[model samples]
Target: MNDDSRKAGGADQDPFFMRDPEKLAANLARTIEEAGKAAGFWSRARESGMVSDSSFDPFADMLRVFSALGQYWFSEPSRSFEAQTRLFTAYMGVWMRSMQELTGQAEPDKPEAKRPDKRFHDPEWVQNPFFSSLRQIYEVTARWAEELVERADTLDDLTRLKARFYVRQIIDAMAPTNFVVTNPAVLRETLKSNGDNLVRGMQMFAEDLREGGGIPRLRQSDLGAFEVGENLATTPGKVVARNDLAEIIQYAPSTGKVLKRPLLIVPPWINKFYILDLNEKRSFIRWAVSQGHTVFVISWANPDERHRDKDWDAYIGEGIEFALDTIKARTGEDEVNAIGYCVGGTLLSAALALMAETGDQRIASATLLTTQVDFADAGDLKVFIDEEQLQALEEAMERKGYLEGGRIAMAFNMLRARDLIWPYVVNNYMRGEPPLPFDMLYWNSDSTNLAAANHSYYLRNCYLENNLARGRAELRGRKLRLSSVKIPIFNLATADDHIAPALSVYNGSRLFGGPVEFVLSGSGHIAGVVNPPAQRKYRYWIGEVHEEGFERWLETAEETEGSWWPHWQQWIEAQGNETVAARSFGPDEEALDDAPGKYVRKRV
Candidate 1:
């Protein structure tokens, strides 16, 4: 037949009989028929004792199919009701088998067997017929809905549809699945291993529910906790520290004499400064105190909205300047050794640079821990600091008068979304398991807000413009230049840090025009800095040439493992004045009272 005649005949044929239409209608009809058949089969199976009354309910299965179809239809432009219905049925079938196993029901094909391990016992909630049925129904319905959504061809449309939900699914799917097991037959073996894990997870959830807890509280494992030096708490040394917002805690050493040079610790306002004085065994502060160093940490005041107006200049003026002056006044010394951590480190660098520009030399030595003076290569976080994102974030902060800590945490988490966010999704939702409490997670959750002005300025200038590395950064109208501050510098960075990559930290040595000792610690950002010697999980690489780049120095430097704190101690001791004398910054200012300063205490 001619093409035109064939086309006319095709158009004239029954609409339902057309190729595409027929296929689609057939698929839909088949889905509805199968769904009805499934309902009947389940009902018969229940009556035939193939599935226990407690494990299977025909009504619940119907609800799941209805819910899945409803969701699928509601998704307008992208519809897959039949496909989703099939997925729903498949998921329900699997869940029914699982429920049967938990409810002491024996399948005709395979007999039920009891697990010998108490840890593998099914939870009471899982055994409860009502809860189990409801859970399976909901899970199957949700999974099917997700399957429908995931079938979309375009990410752009998916992003606009349910952006966060789709992002989470994408992240979960992409998360690391590889393990170090070498056996070729490990897949089947691992399934057996997973059976026990599933049971254990179920039991864990039941216990938590029984106790009215969502997650188990985590404790410092035996291997995680270590003691600090004995001298950490020996005496109420010349330095008396107080947290006005919290309580006053006195730290004294047994030394007959304090160091002639006073020490001032500048910790990032983001975290508590106790990391330096973590415990008796791993405490760097304790070790320094034993070595007769007159040390004092600037416990930042956790600020609230009341202190929203406080800018970077104010932090330098009232915070570091105040601490430095106080130390100078107390010790009767003109200069003090300053140590800064992370943001605190950057602030110290700025302060020193500003001081040097004005020819003020109160800072004798600057030791920066996991600190970044140049933000040119600031790692993964750079992605979120792009112009568009920064503008949106700035607008957000302007409305709130501060950058919310939760927002900042979210940004950080995005750098490793699969690791940080998706695992929780799989455990909490997919597996019906509760989250496990972790101290690090607790600390991470306890976040602090950043002042609106400071955050906005920091992003626009340092991260976006690369001002710090370019030497165009300014503090209070004064151009801040690291090279101008020719002071002895000690810069330390961790190898696996995501926030401040080692390469970025290493670039600091080149930025400074003075003698720089670049040390590479073995750990992530926080862990590396909080590392105490007792853990024995740290290593460091140090290079002698202060002017050379990190890569060049790495080629010549020796690699060594263990805490680098002792090495830092030796470096400080070598540069610090040997004489022991009480040097006070000023008369004990009763302005604030101890560990967590007021600024840190302010809620995000």
Candidate 2:
């Protein structure tokens, strides 16, 4: 890092850039020398009529299928003349667009004119004629490839899914912005730094190659900007209870007279729980405390091979079940208001159903944020799920008895490539600049691993089979059903959420046999939930509870100006009448430290 940034330090104190000028300079020299060779290769490739980004060959995708089949001699792919014809037509269309571009009268991409894809939203993309044409034609080609694969008659669903997966991956990889020669931003950065950026980008790439097994996940220096308890999850709280399965945290109440019923937050174990409890400015935990509600959250164990056998039954039994018990015991309340985010909400729903079946009516109400119990339309994530894919994932997990965190992260990141993936590539690898320290992103890069059996069970039962929505899912030998959940449900779905897909969350709420007040937040998964009134950022919509679907609700629902947290507080507060004095914090044991807790610091 530069001398100034080096002293900026870790998350303990506020730090910004995690860059070193000297190392960056040395790395850029070597990077430029290699890039010189790659540029030569690109010139030759251009002469050969291979117009594309990426240092590697791009045309292999069409014929790449043949190479795969040839490698597996015994395997055969059914021929589809129609599929071939469609692809040929797509190529011809691309050529026509290219010809138009040469004549300086490129036909406007009509489909995109109606509704443009945000993937190429950068002003520089269209600001340059060459880049604009490249982007338009590339997108046209990508859409065609994805559609044709989806409509392929000869390919099995799994094969087709995998093909589409590869198609998107290839398209994302080939974006003009990825190359320094093509990207204006990178070019400017290169010029400004006088080759330092190039050196830093190469060093970053090499470091990623060494540490990430070829895929650079996060800027390590940027990640070092924030420590868990000190900066990120710095809310005042105590690990009131801990178990082998999870850590139950009860945040100190900010109010004098708190709600009679404690609020229990069940965050998705796919991620750490601190997402809802990050910095105090945006912390839902701190917000809840300030709203006069005693908040409790589950800090899931970062599972390793030793915890491989843990399954659906175990998560339902030991995860939420244990948290509920601990919250009830500690708060001296028989029943508590439960809140779940993403998969944590899903698990909480399952546990609540199991509790209902067994006559444990300990939950007075439930709130689900960007979570779905129904997986009938689980969005793009379904592409990586099914018997075939699950088997493949299982085999991979078998190697370590746990699903690799990065591999799992890839599927989610793919959902919004432009937002999650590419910006990092440009910033860290292209500009030789590290990320600006942001709390939400810090929590995002800080990922946790998943157990083999638990993940498999979740996929097979939830995503692949759609058992949870059907009310046929079973946990711990008990027939579980969302219909069994009778608590007043506060269902929050983000309008722009790619992960939960507001519609899916809306669909899941229908399975519940209770009065569910559905609220549609303004943005995607994390931002939608992290909406604080202070920012006045995105607006949310809320409709009357009815049988109509999401689209209909959007048409008729009332739009609200700011954050939905206040609305939620009003709704939740109405659930109970009396209030009691706030309770104290801290666990009886010594291991678990302040707010963020030790479990969050446990990285895989």
Candidate 3:
């Protein structure tokens, strides 16, 4: 495994490597050797309050404990734990009651039993109380262990962080679903496939060890089916303009006549821009085009070591400004409605603020989606954003020039261990089943790097300092206030976004200095925003952004069924004025390649 991958928690070693008898024997020997060293370290640390020999200090010990507690609580490890705990606790109680019923020793009448977590609501899990009780007992024990770790007063933050991650991983791996001995599905599949699943899984493990630094996220079959322009970002368009930082994609008009003010989408450069143009049905770019709006999506260059020196200001000048210039020149429209997602919105907002200060009026209106301008409560992601972590990250970035996209993916997967981590562990490594070829997952697995300077400046200024919200941020040699962005703005926040919580997004809306329409949509970060009107799956709510709190707004607001895309389009239509002559991406403004462009294809 590469040194970089080892630094990323060493998933390449395969947390479940012991499943093979030979590997288990080898691991057992290694564990014995490592355990002795660990015991020595623990004994030294416990007695002396230092890993190296030193006199122990009670005050120092207390401080270490406090720091650890801060890291644990801040990381939001229990965000989903509570739900799982409740489900298991409830399931155990239900089984107890059901047993009493079966014995004809039941008490008064009550409702039927149900699993706490819907994913584990396997009918078979409930049909047999013995198995159900087993799971519940394991879950209860795991929760107790988590509580014990959280309450530990001796461990430092780094120690606790490692402990918590390992504990959760150990517990998650021990779950019945992970092994044929415990899991019915695995047992059945094993009998049917004659242990061939294990063979494939081992092969996958070997291949992942060979390629992606030992961590295999999805089955190769899942990846084999999709490509960038052919599958995702498939919407027909031309790379009308190209520069060092970004490629401007002016999509083909899906309407007879398009709106006068074209829309230029500024997506987070930390990722490829095609997230807006994922596919035909879900692609926001195609949707905008069909809405009779001239859509232009910026495809950011996938940065390498070459882009290590490219800072945040470079993105503003070359990324946003460069695209803005192209949109104006092509459409002959002086002002264009701009939409920014994630960090892109943060930059666009800064740009608008700078422009407002400098008397530049290139933007007609603005829409910020699932993005944050305020860093105070940037959600569980903040757990890894504190001073020590940032400094360590900076050191790593300095060595690499840019932070690998895989590293970022690991952090996010950690945030939602159950949803993002363990299921894939089972599917790709245990069951040997290929993951579904979902479009969003494809985009998710396909990640892009953050340049060292770009990321460090952002981490220090925006996340660490919280300077942007304080109006202390400087851009293009000018001090700027974010609130100076007085353009009419529409903001969308997904209810379950872990990266940028709905409330955080709401707080950013308060920073805007114009008419604000804040809509709270259902689902999570990416899925919530990508929702098309056709899904008709999740609901959204829009209440007046009053002095009332976000919780108060939720309590009082009425939810409207279906996607917020229509509502957003309505707002844009009103702000963009009337429709004009249709214009397909005029022949590539200095064409480099096609719509998906060279930048989208660049991978680490």
Q: Write the per-residue lDDT of candidate 1 for residues 298-370, one digit (tens) a residue.
A: 7665555655677777778777877766666555778878899988898888888889898888898989988
Error of 1 at 585 (Å): 13
Model 2: ten consecutive residues of lowest lDDT: 49-58
Error of 3 at 272 (Å): 2.2
Cα error, residue 203 of model 2, in Å, equals 1.1
Pick by lDDT: 1 or 3, better one: 3
Per-candidate local distance difference test: 0.59, 0.75, 0.73
Estimated TM-score for each candidate: 0.61, 0.80, 0.79
Judge candidate 2 against the unseen true structure and give its global Cα lDDT, from 0 to 1. 0.75
- lDDT per residue (tens digit) for residues 43-95 in model 3: 54446522221221223433554466556555676744664566567667757
In terms of lDDT, the best-performing candidate is 2
Candidate 1: where are CA atoms >4 Å away? 1-250, 424-440, 546-548, 581-603
Ten-residue stretch with the least lDDT total in model 1:
178-187
Candidate 3, position 420, lDDT: 78
A best-first ranking of the candidates according to their TM-score comes to 2, 3, 1
Could you arrange the candidates by lDDT from highest to lowest?
A: 2, 3, 1
